[model samples]
Target: MGSLLSVFSGLFGSKERRILILGLDGAGKTTILYRLQVSEVVTTIP
Candidate 1:
């Protein structure tokens, strides 16, 4: 519930790698989330 960038960086920095993707209906939330998940997973694997 704060700066998403800060949270993301913190998680990434700590190797926690938690992700939260959210958006309202008709906002392409699911699609974006799916892509983001794939990207994150890909990036995280080295």
Candidate 2:
């Protein structure tokens, strides 16, 4: 029981990890990821 509790606590205590975006070319994946990381507005044209 103590080990299970420790595992759960460890899992929940860590910070969120970096996001992984997978897509084909011209899919705006890079644009979106950058925008989120920088916390700023990003502009792009289709």
Candidate 3:
């Protein structure tokens, strides 16, 4: 976890990677979050 955090921190100024999907209130923010956590993506802000 610490190393992962460092990787995110290291991307401080690099080009960002973003994926945006829109849906209603009960859509699936939780599901997306779960996938991201499991995938160990370095950073995501939204």
Candidate 4:
């Protein structure tokens, strides 16, 4: 929600932010996103 967005905004010092995650196939990109969302690690299958 608003608070979560604010945390990210504060980290990057911006009111608006765009993020892109680039990696090879099966390189755990989904895993990284999952970690960010939940603040924990989980297995991801491409």
Better of 3 and 4 by TM-score: 4
- For residues 11-45, write the lDDT of model 3, one tens digit per residue: 88567778777888656675677677696433444
Model 3, TM vs. native: 0.35
Q: Candidate 4: list runs displaced more than 4 Å.
A: 1-14
Best by TM-score: 4
lDDT of 1 by residue, 1-46 (tens): 5798888888678565556767675666566665766764221221
Mind giving the per-residue lDDT tens digits that candidate 2 earns over 1-46?
A: 9999999998988777776679998988868876877977587665
How well does each candidate superpose onto the true structure, as a TM-score?
0.33, 0.44, 0.35, 0.54
Q: Which scores greater on TM-score, model 1 or model 3?
A: 3
Best by lDDT: 4
Question: Considering lDDT, which of the candidate structures 2 and 3 is the better prediction for this target?
Answer: 2
Clash count, one per candidate: 0, 0, 0, 0
Q: How does residue 1 of candidate 3 score in lDDT?
A: 100
Clash pairs detected, candidate 2? none
**Cα shift from native, residue 19, model 2 (Å):** 2.1
Model 3: residue 28 alpha-carbon error in angstroms = 0.8
